[model samples]
Target: MPEPKEIGHQIKFPNTLMGLFKKGWWEIPEIMASSCLGLLGIGLGFIAVLNYVKNDGDNREYKKVYMIMRPDDPRVPRLKNPVYTQYKG
Candidate 1:
């Protein structure tokens, strides 16, 4: 049995038009495809964080408004005797 390194080295490639250059991570087309996908994920993560922060600030503002409002705002109706009614024809 050949040594692992020797076995790995035994794989030969012809010096063709496509095989002239050495293979590296950046040399592979799949790396570029994955890089684009990673960039999109990073962009989406940034947008999500920005939205979360914006919504957190909005929540703080709404809480402050709620604290300052009067008990009897016409827009805020009180629920009295909450019950479910069934209609029969």
Candidate 2:
């Protein structure tokens, strides 16, 4: 019976940078284009996260205003006297 082949010994890895280039898998233009697109995606993602955080603060402010303005709303707690009374001159 034939001996079973070793699993990891068959996998070939380049020992040097020159050997890697000789493999025909590393094209300069394709690498540059892919890297640029990856950077652009990361930048856009960062901007989206920042915008979401900023908008979250604005949303909280709007919710506070809505609750105060519509005290009669079931969601808002009932109070004997309103928090913001008009100032009389």
List candidate 2 stretches off by more than 4 Å. 1-27, 57-89
Error of 1 at 72 (Å): 14
- List model 2 lDDT by residue over 27-83, tens digit each: 466776687899999999999999987655243422334444564675334333346
Query: What digit string (tens of lDDT, one per residue) describes model 1 on residues 8-81?
Result: 34444456744533342325778757877999999999999999886553433223333333446652243332
Best by lDDT: 2
Candidate 1 minimal-lDDT segment of 10 residues: 75-84
Alpha carbon lDDT at 64, candidate 2: 38
lDDT of each prediction vs. the true structure? 0.55, 0.61
- The TM-score values for the models, in the order shown, are 0.35, 0.35
Candidate 1 residue pairs in backbone clash: none
